[model samples]
Target: MISFVIKKGTNSNEMRENNSSLITANLLDWYKKEGRDLPWRETSDPYKIWISEIILQQTRVAQGREYYFRFIEKFPDLESLAMAEEDEVLKLWQGLGYYTRARNLHAAAKAVMDRFNGIFPSTYSDIITLRGVGEYTAAAIASIAFNEPHAVVDGNVFRVISRLFGITLSIHSSEGKKTIKKIARSLLYTEEPGIYNQAVMDFGALICTPTQPKCVECVLQDWCTAFAENRVGELPINDRKIALRNRYFHYFHILQNNSTFLQKRNGSDIWKNLFEFPLIETPLPNDFSQLVKTDFFGELFGGITLFSVDHKLAIKHRLTHQLIHTHFYQMIIPEEIPFNPPKNIFKIENEMLSDYPVSRLTHKYLETI
Candidate 1:
């Protein structure tokens, strides 16, 4: 029953053409001669590779490389990351916005320790089961680490394959994903899926770039429809992105006995594994003076030394569809939080503060203090 339906959707006509064979060979040859010497590219270690992949998710190679090196120096392996302090992890991830990836790496490290016994899951599905893993990440890790035959369909892959094959499917559409996945998988060389995958990704990033791609120099230009048709700008369709909603965050750093209370974000959202001071989110900016007078606000900073800093820094943190304007209040009080303070408010020491991972926005507050 499933076979008949599968036959209708599969694109076996392209599969039978055998066009990608020489293209794959030429591209791999080109990759061997021209590939960049990246740290992650040299290693087969799953942890290191996974870290690089996640860091590069919404970040560029150059910026992501700095974080990758910095992170590796701090936590060299899964055990170190698993045993590290939350603040320590966040601190390591400080400048690299998207604090959640750091937290997830930490959590996934712990998962590897507890469930996988400190060994990274080697299979495609097993790794995907990790806390923050998505399909694309799982595929990359699986293929790169264990040479699993799963096709990695990341942004680079979407762009390269969609344009090369002249597929007009929107890269963001459900059917488009299926179409690209089938094509990429069909062309994947089972013996060297990892190398092939990396080649295509690099080709897209450097040669098949989104703007003014160097098609004449591309080895795949013969098979690339966008090059032949001279429509390089039109292929690899993308759905119009919805506008990002503005979010205003105001944190009250209540100090009592030198420890500032913090709450870990729960559930599936941004900054999931990171620590933060008490947060009060609003649709728009509020009066800074009135913000400090809330019931819990008054108690947390009671006996205040008249040290209430407002809008100390403003940062625009962009997510997929949300743009958060985060601000921190650098206030100081006794070591003990007031009784009327909001629930879940804890205390942290100034020196010990560097041991936990706080959001990049939050890190700015710590740095200035």
Candidate 2:
């Protein structure tokens, strides 16, 4: 139960400035001894830092670290990523869940090569112009790689700042964002903005965590308003909640000889550009008898004689905003079936199916059967 007392007759601005200096000095001193030894911290390359920052978004450092190593190993540099095909890049990023990040990385890499003549953009303006590069990412790259004095306001920083300042405003609100950004900028160490930013982020991640924050061991505990006021759990509020929509997916795994049929998803829906078994989405989970009577079922497997049908496998996969309940129906047919499939549908040898990148739902089904 550490406490801080402000001296009498001190101006608000002076008090704030003193607190800011205290936070920066104490945080940097703690960071010098406590910061995690991340691979990205070893380099000043904007490309590597950009990759790490992108990978860390909505992902934990432990999980993102392996993915980072894998990505770097496959595509060693920006040129390698730029030269790679979209499918190849997505394949490498298959299990990472957010396919759009991989797509944007590929696009941004090409933009660097084509638009910037293979040179990584140095200025914040040019970096933010690239696809999927937002303010936080741009700030991280600029500060870490170029020593730009732009303050970063990520989830970690939000927690640390909100608690330290005893802010109860919803961080998702515009006013909250403005307040957090202003405070972060005011407290930023201009001489070593990169180290200061990383130090603050690390302090939040390792000390001021969302659950069971290490207040007892924290260097800023005495100055942390939330900690002193016993409101650590209540600060840094977020009112925005995700509304998940339920979707039913009926996947048809039709096999002929040693090959299985797969369809490439098109358009701007979930799992776009990814391969999956021929699908028939329904309003609800329908029985096989009801499914077989539909026009879609007849058109897909009309002439082919069904040797076997297994309707036991059902998978409930939860995405960021959509909860997909997928049921895989395996239909075995003869080798010389005369049924013609759609243009997007093609037969691939069962052994070679692992080569293509499939959605997590499809991957779950494949792993089971």
Candidate 3:
């Protein structure tokens, strides 16, 4: 029934230290009773921890669970992953989107093997040097695996810190991020940094969720400035709008003599190194007749004089910042015709289709037939 709020003069060394201790103690106690039981939290192995971290990025915990298990089963240790082929790694990560993360995981594994003699880095500085590792992931690995004193400032932590201190800055801004990071460090439980880090993250996930948070039963409600000011939802401000672009892709699935044609995506585009049916991207949606008149369609089927379109499928795939409108055209070329595809295009037996890794959209199309 009492009200508690952290006001100005709270930035003083003594006041900050007192508030930090109180927050740490309360968070750890709450975590002990309400923290979610997760597989990644059970181990201090950097390999497993690193894998879980990458998989969880832009992916939900429920979805990431199976991927974490499957990936660890396939490549249990750093040595196993470093020696494995990129195709193998990508194939294992087929359904999971944001494929660049998987590639970076593989690359970082090789770096650890070659640079650190197969041992994972124990410090934040060294871990951040690996491919694809940012400050957050590096801090997580250092604290959880090595018991180092580093505060993790993930989305959860950002929200919790923002609301607790009543920060008015947009989380998307550099100044707001810097302020949150400073506050996170001040509140970190230095003695058990790993436990404290996970505790705060768990608190944010379970009690201080993004929507419909359980504020009534929240342990930090007394000290939550947003709660006192009736602005819980407005505390963690992120007003940046994502600019989404639309792309149209016409995919040709050429079937001939029990074989199909596929091309590995190259260059600095999405789905790089992944295999899919021969594709031509257009600015706007093009029908079958309009498609045949394009330069790409001409170059693709230049050698073949005749072919029949047996089936057509259209799919709209959505990404974080792009909306992909894909059309699949299945063409059956007679065995008598000698077809010479482009140099980048390669022919593979139908049975070998599943052996190559494709994007999620391609995988869905494959499931239909």
**In terms of lDDT, which candidate is strongest?**
3
Kindly list the per-residue Cα lDDT of model 1 for residues 45-70, writing each as its tens digit.
Answer: 99999999999888889999999999
Q: Least lDDT summed over 10 consecutive residues: which range in candidate 1?
A: 1-10
lDDT of 3 by residue, 1-369 (tens): 213555532446676666667777889999998887989999989999999988987788888999999999999999999999999999999989999998999999999989999999988999999998998888888899998999999999889988888888999999999999999998988898888988987888789999988999987776677888889979799889999999999889999999999999989999989999999898987888898888888888895668989557789999999999999888999999988888999999999999999999999899888
Candidate 2 lDDT (Cα, 0 to 1): 0.86
Candidate 2 worst ten-residue window by lDDT: 1-10
Task: Report model 3's TM-score to 2 decimal places.
Answer: 0.94
Q: In order, what lDDT does every prediction score? A: 0.78, 0.86, 0.88
Instruction: Please estimate how well model 3 matches the true structure, expressed as its whole-model Cα lDDT.
Output: 0.88
Q: Candidate 2 at 189: error in angstroms?
A: 1.1
lDDT of 1 at 212: 86
Please report the TM-score between candidate 1 and the true structure.
0.81
lDDT string for model 2 (67-130, tens) is 8999999988999999999989888888778888888999999999999999999988889998
Q: Estimated TM-score per prediction? A: 0.81, 0.94, 0.94
